[model samples]
Target: MTAPIPTVFIGGNHEASNYLRELHYGGWVAKNIYYLGASNIIWFGPLRIGGISGIYKSHDYLKGYYEHAPFQGSASRSIYHVRKYEIEKFKKVNSPIDIFTSHDWPEGIERYGNTEQLLRCKPFFRREIENQELGSLPNRTLLSHLKPNWWFSAHLHVGFDAEIQWHGEGSTPYPPADPSKLPSSVPTYPVQVEKNQDEIVLSDLEDNSTDDDSRLAKKPKIDAGGEITNHNEPGCNIPNKEIPVYPPPSTNFYGDSETTKFLALDKCITNRRFLEIIDIDTGSEETKPHTFYYDPEWLAITKCFSKYMSTAQGPDTIPSNIIDEKNPDELEKAKAWVKDNIKDYRILDNFAMTASGPPPKSCNPSTNLNRFNRPKFNDTYLYRNQQTTKYCQMLGIDDPFTAQCPENDTVSK
Candidate 1:
């Protein structure tokens, strides 16, 4: 509440997952503080900020939001894992995104940067980086699909910068004369793939072999003074310390298809300051408004795909790929519904605490050493966060989590 500037965030493992579950559609967690929810897009004047919360796991990624409050077993931790059900709706995104953020780095992102330097810092990462098991596979797919101007992520404790060049179809690595001439339709990712532990095996592996990712790692050179120098990565001025960063122009697939600037920072400590401020020209400087806006398009997409939301803890696969929003008429109807149902597109600045703080550890007593029964965490009751309740009410939908419990009790998996 004491934050002087408007702060926004995405969730990682170290959080109260139950509270985040309540506001699945995203909401103000406290005054001037916003949680991006599971997946969403918001507008601040001309800037379209899109984000997804949580890390990715292959097995759980294909499942639903099965873990409920008063979480038990591995469910407590697994609930924080990323799910494909939430990301499927974004496949319907046809518009451009200005900026996007996630809690973890995109898979194979290390290949696009100073990987050699990274390996020198953390030798343990070499195996995963070599095996292509280091980052989020789904996010890498989204990176190509959305092609936002700027992407930010932090999970691996390091500071790095890289750019992704959106080479077009037919195996081309350059944009055409008129980028708008390029296709706006997103590519369909494999609906089901052979899953290995921490890996999604793609059929197109033969074509991806030439990415020369090792060369990208070799691009970074160290001078005698220990400053970082790039061999071939152009227009990127990666810093040893904080410097003014100017975000490249918003990516226009038909124009400059190679404009995504990816930046990931290390954990800040002692004398190192990782904070960077980029001067963005989001329309006009004279009328720089600071207010939260619900993106109508994102809302429409969410409404159309709400039925695909999963809450099963088992192997119940949600047929989310079957959703066909490509038909222009269907999406238009959803937008019309959003307009008619929601009178004000601007999010009201209301924040409320929906659950009590975690009980003090002193309240927990040690159980019998030989007792193997699951410990009861009945001290806290189920909380139906009203922000989500009211948001769903306006959208002419039920709160996916609370609605399942009906009486505001624990949601049955």
Candidate 2:
């Protein structure tokens, strides 16, 4: 019988932690499966100048700190710290690591096109891609040297229809590889020195060429020096009254008749459906009331609203109590009722169904009760401790969560 191939998936951040927990509980945790790194690994320090001075105090502290820490100061120091931490983690793992999976494109693989723009605009990213000197980072270079046959990553979101090869030299953009001609190699084992010899092949299953092509076609043409030029102007602007300001005769009608206004609404609604209900009297645009149709799949609106009524607003403005705290017996019954009826029991009270006035500006209107239940702001240190404890408990591993340090105990004495 063929031996199961060892796989190591590395994901850091909240989304990854949730996914890992689901995978573990869902019976997807295989004997060969290993989480190569911790979920909440980034190290953020205080804004104070000397805060980072005493940062690297211990191995565990330093590991957790730098994993999520910003890559500032000399590139060499940042690269060395990150690489050292990652390599140490890899070494500490007893499992035969073969695959390296991540939610991000390993350092240097982000330079295909518009990477800078994408990174700048992206939300919830722990570190800016620009601050990360991708080519200079040891992780990308060393990954090639260590030679994990497959590297699975997802943050880019766009699919790769054809297999792409990383040259391993630097940020070299190359054409996509033909999937039909791709070779299949035996899964590498720990002792397999030949593992690093093979080229890393990215799966084409996630390729989104149709969207890419459409985006590319829409990109306004630029001159050699990268300046946009108006193709319509002969040399410069030469106003001609005969020429219609708007193209397409169907939309450029000068007459202010009922038919013209109706045609205008039809044309505008085709692009912006929200323009369907323009207030003629107020000269304001409003969304049609009928546009807000009920979607049965929307759990927040369907489930929460059906069972619960909105509560009166308070001075401090906290969510009204969903369970009867004074009565423990009733609380248990309420919890049981929620668990049995609701699709996501953990999130029932989170949505704040009883809260009055408009929700917080940052809050998504579409967010369900379960999503709101989890606190948005996180206390990193406390979160890390809890995550570590939970991970150890779930895996039946030794508890790694530490309280007061040995030095603190000595100081107290």
Candidate 3:
């Protein structure tokens, strides 16, 4: 049976690490469904979509490790957190975005709208919301950076909406100024200014290329005279040398700088109001006005994934360089290493079979685990504390969100 509307999703903190690893660049999950990866932007007709997976964890952001089977304790967290590399790419293409999605809510986003009504709706969050101690710090920072028209999120298991208003002067706060407003000027000498172009030049050291190790096995040898020579050539007696490659460019992490609106969905599996559909007007019309346009900055960001992203491959086999070597002992040793470290690759000929079967008619409230499954408060508090301290130190200020989440008598100490 065919469905009425197409569906798509972004990864949450509890994503299937192996599955996502299989589709790093976001392969199709079903006939018309797709998964948005760690960092990406795509176009559906005229609508431009951008998304970043996972929640924000300080440690996970630091170590953006690739997925491996026999998942470790931090495996889930590592796969789902917003990594420094992803954020760096966003900063590099610093421009306006259309629709953005993250797993967690932005920190202290309550003040952008009616917090009193939000508290009234969900009394259980009275303590956290009133204290301005909910949501994610990294998400808040990203929201300010990528000022999208509409933001969608999940993982907190409660559906809420608010308009995060950006103020004052900035490219993000308002739409691009009317080009017609500029004064006409006399023709001047033609000059060229360097425009930003998208490029991904990965170093050998940081290269996660599927065949990188194989290429390394056949790397040319350097002779004493500083000349690069092949060891396989006749009369060549120099031993093969291993060169230490340098790491990728260091990424700079910055804080939020603008306002944005957000709509966080509840637990889809166990909530009656699981789905929240947003209607966006793509045309420019009054009352039904739609200001969305083709964003080149966002287009540049998506290109990063298109040209250089990695592809999931089968089990590790000995490189052809090792197999084709003249020596027989080298082949045997390589086989032994593979036997000890590599497992038989699981055949996933039909990758779409991994998709969740289909949507249920309704979520049973009797089986809901909201009470027992609430996230820890102290953990959230500690994260906010760390973020606050870091921003304060960086900005040389006592408080970073003083203008946003101001101190009030009713606020928690």
Candidate 4:
């Protein structure tokens, strides 16, 4: 007799929706075992662990949470697929997470490291490689922004490993288009706007005629030496002293160029590479150095979700007074909002297009039994269990999954 080893899991596209929904924030799925549901980030000592549950599809990316149990028509789609608002928590935190996981594979990741080896191993995936549609586009976008040290994914039932090199801030680099089709001069703006939530109130400012306004118009006094002096301040005669300068600080947590080791495991039933044992040196100077800083550009991209989602969802959620004909002022405000959020809307469109290769494939959720509702017990769970039991039998051990014990022995305090 032996104690059962604890296991943790994140849900995939095929899961018991009701069961997962009960412990959405990831309560224990089994004794001493846990589930990391939806978009959850947790910590284990120095290691920061995070995961996004469920598969990705364009339409399902930005909606309020929905789930249905008992495998109803189309209801299971909402129940299993990752929702739009689920990722909001990720946008709020800018810390460098150590590890990340998802159910669906990240799209176009094969191009980063070694595709030759990948194709040689999984020749059946050649079509997906050619079309660049093997994995999730939203996952690619998130991976680019988060730049975690490692990423693990499943659902493809294939054992694969690769390194995805971070290409730095902004979108992935694209090759130049046709010279004739390109613009004569690329549009360049002198000022680049950094987006944030600070507002400057122009109403508070006044012309020079007002007493408060006079302070704004005041000019600094310039001496013969060409050094400017502040005339308004009383203590403006402080002597200057030279201070020691320090070297520029590093802005990396891992002390190395951000690159993620991505691994996808095969099904346990396959009895081949079913699990991976990795050693993460959390205390190493090369890994756990404390100079990590969040990339603000990536944060901005994450925070833009609400703006884009609003546009994609349309003005139905807009206030009735703002959209209704009764109040013209509010209606104008709503219109202005729509116009202002157009940039984010367009950004989302471009992101989806670039990541997924094409628009998301349209399949009827209600009628598409292959894609949505139909569940296979043997493929998902039972077959794996049976295979494990058979393996145990070959080794002359009792089937751990069904080993019987005395009633007194099974009793717990």
- Deviation (Å) of 272 in candidate 3: 4.0
Clashing pairs in 1: 178-254, 179-254, 179-255, 180-254
Question: How well does each candidate superpose onto the true structure, as a TM-score?
Answer: 0.72, 0.27, 0.48, 0.48
Error of 1 at 239 (Å): 2.7
For candidate 2, the per-residue lDDT at 161 reads 14
Candidate 2 off by > 4 Å: 1-83, 91-98, 110-132, 160-398, 404-413
User: By TM-score, how accurate is candidate 1?
Assistant: 0.72
Residue-level lDDT tens digits of model 3 in 1-413: 33245555788755655455434435445455566656666544335567877766543344434444434554534555565456544544443555788877777665555565454333344566665446666566567667777888876544566775686654233332232422223223332422111111122324445332243336654544556644223222111111111111111212233556677765444322457555765442323112112223333333322222222211122334432344335334433443343232111123335323333447454443234343222111101123233323322334312222224421122
Give me the candidate number with maximum TM-score: 1
Alpha carbon lDDT at 296, candidate 2: 14
User: What are the per-model numbers of colliding residue pairs?
Assistant: 4, 13, 1, 2
What overall lDDT goes with each candidate model?
Answer: 0.65, 0.26, 0.45, 0.47
- Cα lDDT tens digits, model 4, 316-375, are 133333223333453334334433432221000010110112223485545443332442
lDDT of model 3, residue 269: 41
Question: Candidate 4, 332: how far from true, in Å?
Answer: 30
Misplaced by over 4 Å in model 3 are 1-4, 120-133, 167-259, 269-271, 284-413
| Model 2 agreement with the true structure over 1-413: per-residue lDDT tens digits | 11165333443221233223222211122343433333211110100000001111111222222222122232112222222223222222221112334443445444443443333322112243555422223334333333333334443333211122344444234332222322222123322222111112123213533322233334444544566543222222111101111211111112221110110111111222122222232112332211111111121211222222211111111123522133234334543443444332110111111112345768765662234353343212111223333433432333322222122231100
Candidates 2 and 3 compared by lDDT, better number:
3
Evaluated at residue 348, the lDDT of candidate 4 is 9
